[model samples]
Target: MPETTPRGLAGLAFGGDYNPEQWPERVWDEDVRLMREAGVTMVSVGIFSWALLEPAPGTYDFGWLDRNLDLLHANGVRVDLGTPTVVPPAWFYRAHPEALPVAADGVRLEFGSRGAICHSNADYRAAAANITTRLAERYADHPALAMWHVHNEYGVPVSACYCDSCAAHFRRWLAREYGTVEAVNEAWGTAFWGQRYSCLEEINPPRRAATVGNPAQALDYRRFADATMRENFTAERDILHRLSPGVPVTTNFMTALSQCDSVDYWAWGRETDLVTNDHYLITDGRRTHVNLAMAADLTRSVAGGAPWLLLEHSTSGVNWQPRNPAKTPGQMARNSLAHVARGSEGAMFFQWRQSRRGAEKFHSAMVPHGGTDTRVWREVTELGAAVEALAPVGGTRTEADVAVLWDWQSWWAQNLDWRPSEDHDARERADAYYEALYDHHLTVDFAHPEADLSDHPLVVVPALYLMTEAAGRNLREYVENGGTLVVSYFSGIVDEHDAVHEGPHPGALRDVLGLTVEEFSPLLPGERVRLSGPGGAGLDADVWTEFVVPRGAETVWTYADGPAAGRPAVTRHRLGRGTAWYVSTRPGAEGLAALLGQAVEDAGITPRADLPRDVEVVRRTGESGTFLFVINHTAADTEVPLDTPGTELLTGERAAGRLAVPAGAVRVVRLGG
Candidate 1:
């Protein structure tokens, strides 16, 4: 495995995306000076600079890039050099219009925006390879180069293309996956509605249809799109590796966002040398910190518990949201440190300097539009100092006792057109469980359902709708081997092809859960059912309900009032020395927390610390020592009881007993060697 730490960096990597090509040459000197003053150590360059790198077809421009790289090296700032392939130059697309992607409605998308080229387009692939090869060959041994950032966000604007090239590519991919049309028919359940194809050529990308499209076809198309993206990423990565041997390569992942659904990070993680992510806060009354923590945890898990990078986040308000609220006073610092608390060894942003023009003009950067005197720049400098102060955090690994199952295939199939409830979003369900664990100050790591669960004391699978036979067997083995398994409603209902299981509703897990569901009772919008359990522990269940019949599992919670009144809403089954718990309804936060608390107790798992609500704690162990990060996300001052003894890295003061963390602030306590 590639080491999580950046190769030559002395401390935690601190800086943001730097674009010297946007400004005049004189401004480049001033930017480097400012970066050093702010304690910036690294900057990502050449992102979205395809037009500048190659102004015309087969033409290259490296004079300006060479000057900037030399200047940054002289100023002691390392570089994460990007390939500038996210957006192809306009002239190439003008010459080969076939490279433009076609939308689901068959409208050919133009070349004005980024990610406009179809991944399967032969012309686009060739052009991308040519440019990447040139870049790697030119900068193979550059002293300033620290890492290779291959392409910007992959599936952002244009995830799937419906053009002829993509259709052909999709058929070819299906052939590779299924081997024959008959096998495809069996896997896709093409016999339904007489949708079976006689030949491989009949299949196409999931374009718009008169009625609902085939779910199996749509699922396969999603798989194909991800595979194409991975292939594209690997092509660039291979060029970089072959040319610049030891340099780490990565593509920034848009974690926990809607765009993340298109690619499988677990598979992508294997290709990249380092795992990195770009997460912007969703400011619509959602718990932005929770989302950030979730993204960081998932990124760390994808990196195999190694420290990852926070490739992008806004210093203030983002321009994209309907109402992009600016981060108050210390919110930016708090947000950045929250990522560090989880597993990120670096804290970076979208851009180093604010854009003077373009779509992202209003997006916050390290240096705001208002020069160095502004609050954004001041906060950026302070964050840079904080990151520099906590230099020992580099290469540290966050220890997680709980593993939450996150599967992209399950996520895709769960949200398919025909489901139990329209509101049954897979991520939201997973977040609900994750939030419950977060509420308990427990460190959590995301795990694929098929991943080994023996390492984690507690495994929570929320809304795993499409459970494969392998995954089902893995869960059974996990539970039978003394692991605690918690599964929610609508899980293990089908195989990989979106075909329902023959027996029980949660077909594959029925034996492990020791229960069978007679029918699914999906509640209407605003409709809810009451659930009651031991000691009058009650909560409202909404969205979905399963009429579960227990065979050998003991009832933990029952429906108090509904069509399935008195039915087991929650059941626990003991398999050998282990236990499996099933949740048949969408329980409210309090109820879910209570149930998870019971599971945590039963599994003999301990939290890092008992923290107040809205306060987060994470423990990272390394060669240096164990570092505990306590963050207060609330708007008021809070005190946390800390038993570990060590010096606080942020202030270089002794930390023990109780520590006061101000509102929107973080505390990094280095607990003993």
Candidate 2:
């Protein structure tokens, strides 16, 4: 797929989320026996066994882990060793009492939750630093260690902090960010609530869910919390640099998770040796496919387009969500390819062996019901064999001229402040933007704030609510330098401070897009508006319907409902040599698909040609060859026809021109680059 990580394993490591730590000596033998039965080659260990790793504080224990490491390496399997920092031990919390987090409702955390480290607390940082340093020193040169797994999922905390450390840090962060308290007060518009603080110590996060009508400290608290967690990550990474300089380290990032601290994928990507993430979906397949693709895409884009480790996925199915669903007979096979079809090189599950007891006891695993011989094990073997068959084509890179900019800081900024419209989740919008491109066969590269767009032929920034002046300037140069630009609704509504723009909704893009959004209408489920299309046929609309007028841009599509009908719901303007398309509404899949198709077509983007919709396609470029992965998500059997002739990698299913794609199956096609 896209060369998300050039410095990755030789081929996709086919197994993940192993807890050899959870099993006994006999069970380890059983796991290895089963692993050999399958072609399983890699394992991610030491995720949440803090209690086991450190039975007691200050005294390190490596006996159980040493044996565990020796076994994996002996079995010819590489291990992604997790640093037991995900959950601090029971004794550490008991001793240094201030490590707990203060909830958003201002409740001081008792030792009740799992990820309980207070980000801004010095005691917590020093203790965490010491533990990581020690752990790295112990395991840096281990034969089985492929990557260092840092703390799990650092999402923006749900509840704000009231602790003195967080407060002081917030004051310092604000002071450096805005210069003085007066600028902050002005930006937050604190005069309305009489909540202005005389001293920084008096400031506190919202205890209750504050209304959007009243500007609360919740948004800033969320930012500060994310920032603080970042500080923690940097601290640990710096410590690891001293202990394990060669072993690349990273934490598993949950794509849409809000509870852990993340301003954007790139926020941690900078510190991480290699970005690794998890993609779990129990939702509807139609939409969930995009969700999976997006998770992979985000992972690929985070480290400036480096392929990420597909750390954890349910080999069979997931145990969370409204329903803990298992993958259908052919679903697991299809899902594995789905990751590959969207730029992922490796695939792994949450648990290689099933848990006998605990919360994830019901989670699917490769080692099924009765030890060594089972249907799950058979399927695992088959999938592993597939990876081995296609091994020569792995670790390739993809450079799409289309770059889709996605930022986590913008997500936090948008959801933090009060707005007059519907509640919009930043992650969902980001997914929608990415999916729009994917639906049209556009292999989109995820663009972070610092991403260089010069390599891309097109750049689409959807719902960019946190565009700093530099980011805006980047867009301007990209468009002026001949890149097709697309910006969706709520574009340029706010400055970097989460404050509104002065003249119009799209504050920064007036120079590039040549238009300003005066007013917009919130679209509920069925409500929609249409814009004039090719044959006077209008574009479909739903979600967010925006009203727009051009300063110099030309209208491509117009809204069909309310007083704002016929206005520019979609507008295009010529800037320098390239073009910009501003879509001011959250049009449904059809509309988004069409818009992306047209934008790419206009920009001279030659897609994989006319491939089937159910069959997802991806291309990875290497010095020797170009690899194309075609996956059929359909439940019915089908044949695959190629637009460009290529050699089949997996099935030897020749495509001297023609290839067959079985129902719920996949084929990895190779061509000379």
Candidate 3:
């Protein structure tokens, strides 16, 4: 909406969060100097400096931030100025204790960490607005101000607060959404638990009860909490937009992280002028690069297929994970370029200088505790040069070969209590499907279910338990229009109200899939099932199985031996000129690969089957020309099939026909450049 990317940057945006207040005033000079040496063009300042910026109510201290910005501008470094509203100062919290968030158990969260304020509290909103206005008034035209970063990572640590203020706010939100208490009762299915409300005032925030609360109410509360945070963001954003008309405003998003799930990124993506995300690796015995690529692709899609920035990633290990492991040599560059390969304007880290005394002190940074002589510093400088060399690829967008349906609302709805089985995880299904597509060398673009799907010939729905009527119609029409669709288990079961769709199981997708599941036969823990299809094809599945009765679909695979033995486990239907595939059980990796491979073929899409496993190839196209990125995440040297002759950006090597990608190395080719 603003410019599609961060403005006022000469090349690609490259830098990290800079906290000059954390260091002594004397270190400011050295910080900018090192930034220049590392090819840093921008730094986000004052994100958590609320306590320092406003020591007392209405008291102001901008001298330190002014000096820091001036010095960075003098050193040719741009600033992504923060509103410093994520955390209120001690005095403000002391004065307005009602601003503190209350747990679902009715215990008030003390003001000791970040994001402790209740979003519904008027005091916090007023304080946040005041600080934002003051900052906008002071630096609307500052030379170094390139972007306005709003409150840091909304819905992190604290999303919903069960305080009385929130209860009232929830009622008001319900009033606006449903318009009447009868409507709320109907939507919430209050007849079951005798929980019908007489009026909006009787409703609460789904606090602790004897048993599981109303899932419909729980779902609405999640939406309410997300909307409350968004309301605050837009309030601050409107101020910045009014004061600073052209400067793009953004709030770093953790779109792909499991820990931060309350915020619906699709809604937030529309609100931000420029979409940016902060991604950290989980390091949980999986391929971290795949997760990184997934995050980057998701962020780029959130930017509406435009170029987005990587606001925060680690140089090595992060401190918060249960097992923090350092990245091996060259792994950092590979991780960053993998994101670039998908579609990131540039690579940036959490902080420029690592913290010495803070909750995140053990977290890695560009300048680690060991400083410039360390391996991190050396790699940081190398990555800087690499990012600078690929400036021509900045505005270019990565073209996706396939589209994956991703909706946070469905994820939220599916995660509520009293589901089919605990083993059915929405995110896990998404990851499995994404990883399969990645292995097929298919670049993916995530789309909301109701979004236009005509452009993507192949659309995948890994897991979507909650589907709106419009989304169902969209999918049905897409299949009828000759677009191939692949859907996994536990999808299209419920509506927005957490109620099963009327008439049949598999609800909205019943017609499109040409099948209906009468009953879900979830397997016992540690149990597995085998499926046999035509031509003697065999697959192993676990976690779930279903008794699928075909309306018009052909059974491709049947449960060979399980609780639902002889039942259809996988089916295919011919709709219009297109095809729709239904998978009713969770298959192993190899089985999934085989099924997706067939679907890819049905969609008339060609994957890079020539590339070795774990090797990635992505292309970016724009006015600067087409650039092909070949990233090898394996341990052996491999060559990617390339027809066009071009100069490699990373090594300046001339290549034609085929490109050599060494083990753990990244190669960027400016095609015919």
Candidate 4:
């Protein structure tokens, strides 16, 4: 679990969410002792320390915090100071009547529930800003300070937040985005049921339990909410940065969370600096790696294809789940290493110590079993020692030749479509393609839709259902500039307005893909069809079936033995100096692996061949030297042939192709060759 990470703050950041408030003053002594026991140098404090920070709006207390900071400073540990705006005192809520949020169901949220406030609420926003500025002014020169934590889980419980202020702002947001109420109504197809709005206030967000009848409106609402959250995040971030620019600022994002608040990268990434996200892989499973990799990639993408922190991973079982299954022995480290192998720059456990009582009292921790001499502590110590010895692995970076195209606009546009299908959800399909690439030992840079593609030679976008005219044109330019591209089925069916293109299914892409999808034949599970390569026997297509009428492209793969058999399942068309492959069906990972290998070869992308698929290699460049990280994820020990010679980062280790890496072992090698 090693890769080249970001410079400056990039070494093995050994710390996590910390709260000195929960323990007795005497217990803080043991905490310091344990910090040296493990290489724990950083602790994020004040995340939930709001109750202890200020007893009331007018009165504040830092007596406990001063001692906590003094302890960390004396111990030489850095602190990621958090602004306790998440859960303030009951006095603040009682006094600031506008602080509470009105849910979509029109009920003002009671205090106690986290994330139950409208960010647009003037009083709430001002209060949060006030808290951040005060904290910054107080801790600006604090030696224990390493970074600033804006707020704890900014987007949790984001499904609600339909306050009067939010509604008023939502109208303004819609006016700016859609230009006019009539345009908004038309895009939403308000005429379908006479839901047209004559004025902004006439429009109402659906209830907390409301059904998404109009996808266009629903999509816009989702976009507006995301934007609003970003605005709030930026407000807090600016306050912190102004107070202390040297302290890198960040807020933990939740993983691929359904709530739109965690959805948009372009909007919130600017303030986040280095993106960190919370992800809990509920149990030990093969799919866990894929999920963690996706989170790491998302974090990296926000950092502009750089490294990110695995901010919050449970040490064992968490408190809030349908079933709280504890992680098996070695599972926690295994999972954290998976994040490292995939591309997480730094790793930290969720809660340093278990909460003694309350909602998350049972959540796992680094010292769950006891104070210093327990299995969990031993495991943490072993991991820390391994990390310290593996110090050379620090600053190892991951570089990708190919990047998957991801766009919030596409995310918005697809959901805005009238035919936004529950059966063919595009987001899940795209995630599958990305994870497939990861499994193939291909380091893929997860990219925003409009992000620069000039650095990448091959771009894969699966099921991109929503295309604005500008985006389609940009894709054309990318292909014409000699970039190999892959566009899957159900793509380009609708424009930004959710209107069907006149000429064909893929309106602008028909020129690039050289084909048209007449209508999709939704094939269910266990559906059988053979997709063969010219006269090839036993070609496979198990999931989807489609009839392809090629306009100008050559058929590379075809389905067999079905009503749609003998039609093109995979087709390629030459556009400009490059080629475009359109996958008509969702193929298995094996099939996609084969397709990508051939496509990368066709695109002249260097694969670092003669290496095993289970073995991963990434090269990160620095001003002085370049670092190459090799990871072995396979069960059996394997030897990797390296072109590098005498490039040693470890003791008595030689850079040779025959270097043996045990199962789950990672090596940092320099590529002098």
Best by lDDT: 3
| Local distance difference test, each candidate | 0.88, 0.72, 0.92, 0.72
For residues 86-140, write the lDDT of model 4, one tens digit per residue: 7766777888767787766677888886766677778878888888887888988
- Kindly list the per-residue Cα lDDT of model 2 for residues 457-554, writing each as its tens digit: 88888777777767778888988998888888776766666767677768877778998777767766566666676668766666676667799999
Query: Per-residue lDDT for 411-505 in model 1, tens only?
Result: 88887786767877778888899999988888789988788888888899988998888898999899899899999998999888989988877
Poorest stretch of ten by lDDT in candidate 4: 1-10
Error of 1 at 639 (Å): 3.2
Task: Give the Cα RMSD of candidate 1.
Answer: 1.4
Inter-residue clash pairs, candidate 1: none
Taking all chains together, each candidate's TM-score versus the true structure is 0.98, 0.91, 0.99, 0.91
Off by over 4 Å in 1: 1-5, 607-609
Candidate 3 stretches with Cα past 4 Å from truth are none
> Cα miss at 218, model 1 (Å)?
0.9
Clash counts for all predictions: 0, 19, 0, 9
Candidate 2 residue spans exceeding 4 A from truth: 1-10, 156-160, 186-192, 195-199, 206-217, 256-263, 423-426, 523-526, 530-534, 607-609, 637-646
- What is the Å distance of residue 498 in model 3 from its true position? 0.9
Q: Judged by TM-score, which candidate is best?
A: 3
